[model samples]
Target: KLRIRTPITTRMTGCPNGCARPYVAEIGLVGNGPNMYQLWLGASANQTRLAWVFQERMNLDDFERTLEPIFIEYKKSKRRAESFGDFCDRAGKEELERVVNEFDPSQSLVKTTAKPRVSVTTETMDRLTRISDIRGLSPSKLANEILEQYIDSLETTVHAQK
Candidate 1:
């Protein structure tokens, strides 16, 4: 396991429909085919910026091997308290690509990338907190109910449109 200076956000989706909001994550992996994914990087930790495409079709099997060098450089050269996403933004995609391409696996620092997790937007979380407090319900329960309601509404709208 590699230790990072600050928490990094990672999102993975089965498709490129932005369902997981991968575009706003520091490390976004959108599955394009079996065992192949589109890699995105450079978004802010706060989800305020959009991550750009680092690779159109990276082999998922090579995920750790491909990112180890960049992770090493970030760990060694990043400014104090800088996050992985912030470091990626400052380093720029071209330079990061070069580092990845020129990396020697024999000099690997550590293996593995962070496991991906689903997350709600900050705004949604805040809203949930407020509404849950007023209704005396748990924030997670409220969030789930809201999501289910929203999905139902979307389905109704789609059926109406058709």
Candidate 2:
């Protein structure tokens, strides 16, 4: 097991509807079809940045095996206090792809089975559902868009102040 210095925010959604804010998560997994997912990585821990799609379609059975190279590289090369997402961002897509392509799973030492759990209150869900119905968008998608707009507005205000 790798001892990570910071918490990683991983979000998984059953569909592209993004009820879990997967786009902004450090590790986002969006189900594209039966037993297939779009793997995403590189968002900031604070949810300030959007994650990028690392793999367009990854088999569910290959999840742990596919990430072994990445985890190994992270454990060996990350800077002090750097999170998994930060490391991914620093490495970029090209480097990550190279590593994955050249990795020998037989020599791998990492195996992860950790899963994240999230809870939504009924009241909040009901509100989101109502608003989302009126807006013709998924609740999570609407919420994320609003959050992005709010963050952008804040940045604009800060720039104005300066």
**TM-score for each predicted model, relative to the true structure:** 0.65, 0.65
Model 2 agreement with the true structure over 1-162: per-residue lDDT tens digits = 666556888999986988899988889999989889999999988888889999999998788877888888888898998988889999999999898889986786654444443457999889888999999999888777877899999999999999
- Model 2: residues >4 Å from true position, as ranges? 110-162
Compared with the true structure, model 2 gives a TM-score of: 0.65
Q: Over 4 Å off in model 1, which ranges?
A: 109-162
The Cα local distance difference test for each model comes to: 0.87, 0.86
Model 2 steric clash total: 0
**What lDDT does candidate 2 reach at residue 145?**
86
What is candidate 2's CA lDDT for residue 7? 81
Candidate 1 lands at a TM-score of 0.65
Q: What is the per-residue lDDT of model 1 for residues 42-81, given as tens digits with 9 covering 90 to 100?
A: 9999888899999899997688877788888898889988
Best by TM-score: 1
